[model samples]
Target: MSNLPQSLSLNVPFGAGPSGVVPGGAGSAPAANKDRKMASAEQLVLDLSNTELRENALLELSKKRELFQDLAPLLWNSFGTIAALLQEIVSIYPMLSPPTLNPAQSNRVCNALALLQCVASHPETRMLFLKAHIPLYLYPFLNTGSKTRPFEYLRLTSLGVIGALVKVDDTEVISFLLSTEIIPLCLRTMEMGSELSKTVATFIVQKILLDELGLDYICTTAERFFAVGRVLAHMVAVLAEQPSPRLLKHIIRCYLRLADNPRACEALRHCLPDMLRDGTFSACLREDPTTRRWLQQLLSIVGGNRVSPLQSGGGFEHMMVN
Candidate 1:
């Protein structure tokens, strides 16, 4: 069964002026301005329903997303708007099967995703967005192995939606994601995505690890811990050759959080990269004291030990950070 709806309709209107407001009063002008803007936003959203107008409407809505603080609910409750966005996503599946997505298709879908991200970020509608299972629709894009500009942009924009959900420190967000394939998808991106995509994917992982339940989940099994550890090890080796302080910061924080788990810390004693321990990243950490301190805390917690199961030719051996 298709995970998305063919169409949906909700008729919550905007731009109604508050009752009992006197004309030309101090409060009236601001209310009038608010109504006009809301009306314009509503028009832009309504335009999304028209087939010919969908592309320009999506482009405009995405560009002006921040301007409409109420845009999330507006997108959700407006007639046919959310369906239009899903249709935009559905239109791209054929391209994915054939690996034929172009820049134009990628941009349009990303614009749709940007609006979905807005919905995911809003406090009022985030859980509602989750209840509708909207994030699952984005997973295929993240799962793509293509490295072209089109796929890369699609993956990054899709990550932005998940990143927005996790950005606000909510256990529900972590809980929802932990229940899905988000982690493996993120790990794959961390392994193969461009620097920026990897950074966002790592940021998502870092946020998950920061949550207590998420930490317990990842550390609940050696398999999960080593899966994450191996990828972080690979990223560290890559960063050692071509450094990115931004990406390195998230990677280190994930390690520091893992160290908070006793078993993971024990595993890290042997498998944690040598470069992280030997000041290879000192220059990179010079400007970022918080991450520098995180690295220190991780080293201190894992301590100076190199004896563990991972030491005996675990999958991480080839990623030595020399």
Candidate 2:
């Protein structure tokens, strides 16, 4: 233990027996002293200001897979210090770009973060991470267009951190991701990246759009889908080029959901020929009543009084009634 300031060692009752034992017992006092000494040793580790040491301790603790009861309580009590350390850990990202950590060290860091994320599941730590701008630290890697093995590991770690942050629902973090044009960045990344990256990006976009905050941000991304018809067309074109049945289905679903907005419906009408040709749409037409209804509504808006065969020319007219 380092030199203790007076504030850390002001207590005067040093020569006491075990807390519950009688003071006159021959060995009891020494036992109590030993316990106090052990406790003070643990406290000293907790109080250490060297973040690297603390990080190493946390890494070891995580590897042991021991109960967090002891450390969690202490971290909660000294939350300010823990938060400061987290901030410092996050700040190291700039210096550690393309992080120098080998696989083992990376695993240790990730496991430590996982444990901290569990500890920080409470509102206070969430707020602390937000206040410290932790998301900014993580976002850079997401934005990094690195393809090297080292950068790939950092990217994976960054994504894990993002998952942990969002799990906290730190609104500041959410707002930052939204406000900083992350959605568009993600979309572009998906547009240019490999199939796996695109899949992850699509999942992320859908997840964001499912949330109210994310939906609001998306709506604000373009003035209206009609006004950004070219961009919408580009998106449709990208989907049209893909062969994934599931992705096409999701894209159609998302378009249908967006079509509930009059402007989005109008913008989507321009792509109807391509959409109708998609195998997913053909599959749905055979099985999904909702798809039929959406197609009807879309045709009503796009074709006006012009009746399509399904609407008036066949037994399918009765299918809708049933």
Candidate 3:
């Protein structure tokens, strides 16, 4: 997923061709040429319905997704566009089992996912995107265990779609996700994905934890809290070896959010990794003042300096209290 917020500027030029037009450069085009470009992009959207034209159209739109600031409604309102995108996803299911997904095929499905991410990001289309159960279609990609480039790209892009949904403030997005296996899926990524993919997955979890309902859900059971806490603790240890300020920032935010719940906060007092409360990450977080502040606040709230029975380098799982 791109580091930019998923909710930021997803408009597509509905009728424009895939000229990859930049906003500043559009004013320089002749009026007649602009009309043609609009017609071409519209044709490209329409061509999504054509099996022969779909691949090229998907490529053009996906390549220039950032420029499609106004096209989400058009994509959603247009007939068969969403279906076409899902078709692109489902077609690749066969290859996933055998782990035969080459870069070319992965790129094609990822392109389709990019379009879906746009739809997932737009307010007008977001609820509709969820109502269609579209996010579930991408979970298979997230569940795959392959470390190949193609599979990694697929996982990262799929996380982008979920990340886009959670970027919205609505409880409905969290509600939908909490009802699914998204938490475990994200935890799996946090454990095994590349640094970038792990960052996106952790971002998704951070957004979820920021939601009130999501916080309650995670803390509702000792099992759930420990499930999330253990993975986060493990990631902190891994990053301590080879730091990623970006991923570490999200992980810290998640821990801080978990601290907002009384029970979870109490559990964290015993189970929160020393690396987070200690000065271990100070160098890695030198430029990130906000994360540094969050770390301090989390430590203060969880009574960070106190030693626990589990502090003898024991696993976080053993620190959980009933």
Best by lDDT: 1
Error of 3 at 47 (Å): 1.3
Stretches of candidate 2 exceeding 4 Å from the true structure: 1-58, 61-116, 119-124, 165-173, 188-201, 221-257, 271-277, 280-322
What TM-score fits each model?
0.89, 0.53, 0.86
Q: Model 3: per-residue lDDT, tens digit, 115-190?
A: 9999999888999999989999999999999999999999999999999999878898899999999999999999
Q: Where in model 3 is the C-alpha error above 4 Å?
A: 1-34, 309-322
lDDT per model vs. reference: 0.86, 0.50, 0.84
Q: State each model's C-alpha RMSD to the native.
A: 5.6, 10.9, 7.4
- The TM-score, computed over Cα atoms with residue i paired to residue i, of candidate 2 is 0.53
Cα distance off (Å), candidate 1, residue 292: 0.7
Off by over 4 Å in 1: 1-29, 308-322
Best by TM-score: 1
- In terms of lDDT, model 2 sits at 0.50
Lowest lDDT block of 10, candidate 3: 1-10
